[model samples]
Target: MPAPVSTASALPARALLACSRAYCAAAPRSSDICSSLEEQWAKIVLVIKYLGSKRTLVPLLTKLVEASGASTGLDLFTGTTRVAQAMKTLGMHVTSLDSASYSKVFGDTWIALDGETANHSELVDAISHLNSLTPAAGYFTQSFCIDSRYFQPFNGERVDVVREKIASDYSGTWLEAPLLASLILAADRVDSTTGVQMAYLKNWSHRSKHKLELNDPVLLAGQGLAVQGDAL
Candidate 1:
């Protein structure tokens, strides 16, 4: 029998390069990837705090979506719609989907809100009014968790009042959505635990600074974009 060919001689010399080229050709062009939402999300200042958010995974998730050639993104269990909003900012077709009624409320506001005119002055004034309310005596008055180093407390009644005020006063196609999302974010920021409880952090030491600004959708509307419904 003829001598067996060496293993190295079995394949073409340029096999690796050829395979790479074929892979590249079959994949979607990087230029086709949407990136606007990612850029917009990068600019968001976390006003409220949250636990277990996927914000840190944003870059990885964005890259994965881009690589997977997903033309449309549906965010199921869309907590705060952070990832979905980012995808939307990227200009990818994005739908923020959720089952919870509260989530439904958020999705409607974030995904489908609109502003016809720029009202920076008006918005700033509204934010100012919303911030003036003090913590409720009934809830904040009672401490939830106390440690030697720190204590975590919440003004439940005051928070309720704020929610009520927003429900009654704030009106927009999308203003309330981002605004509520932002507030929820802020709540996450201030809470002491990795979970949603009025418990103090074991090592709590951060400046109590409050900053508020108009969220992305409102800004987009201000820029003359027409926003519509928060449907799937």
Candidate 2:
């Protein structure tokens, strides 16, 4: 299979410049702000490789939002929170609402890290510490690996060990959201899934053979809220 193409090249220069021209007044001039946003969007590490992720469409959506003169965004069905995250990156105060518990975790992670320099520094460091954890056997491994071939035993064991550490140590802290999000992202990377969790591939995917590794979220400084509730 071919290496995956990034979502960055989705927008044409003409359209991107048009978006810059129509952007909000509070931020920098068109070219400068557009360049910054484009740079940031390219580097962002979305926490999930979800089935319905709006990752590719975010630029268009944000451009529309900017044209409307809205400085805030409400994503009612924020499945992977990618759109909400994009809006936040575009300097909007965003609220990502979804019924899924995991959606809330993705939202919460962004909110927790979009803080002062000191707090942001501390949070990232603590979350990064999860990488040092030793892999071990546990329920996640048994359920997702042994019982079902969703992930390799190596990656599954790492997820279990890290998850247990997150529960026992990082629970109730700001670290919880990003830490769990990182673990889930790591496991998903090495998973033998056909995108959704409904079933795993009969054979290990090339990606599945890789060891899991947590990636620290790229911090975007702005106001954000993640609510676990219906649109209503």
**Which lDDT values do the candidates have, in the order given?**
0.48, 0.72
Q: How many residue pairs clash per model?
A: 14, 0
Evaluated against the true structure, the overall lDDT of model 1 is: 0.48
- RMSD, every candidate, angstroms: 18.7, 13.9
What are the per-residue Cα lDDT tens digits for candidate 1 across 1-232?
0122222442442254344445556663743332332222221211123445677787899888878887677787776666776666655666666656666556555454433354556655665666676555343324332222122344334444456667788755334655566555454444433223333445442422223222333433311111233545
Q: Which residue runs does candidate 2 get wrong by more than 4 Å?
A: 1-50, 111-118
Q: Please identify model 1 stretches exceeding 4 Å from their true place.
A: 1-52, 68-70, 114-120, 134-158, 171-174, 196-232
Q: What TM-score, to 2 decimals, does candidate 1 have?
A: 0.51
Instruction: Give per-model TM-scores.
Output: 0.51, 0.74
Over the full model, what C-alpha lDDT does candidate 2 score relative to the true structure?
A: 0.72
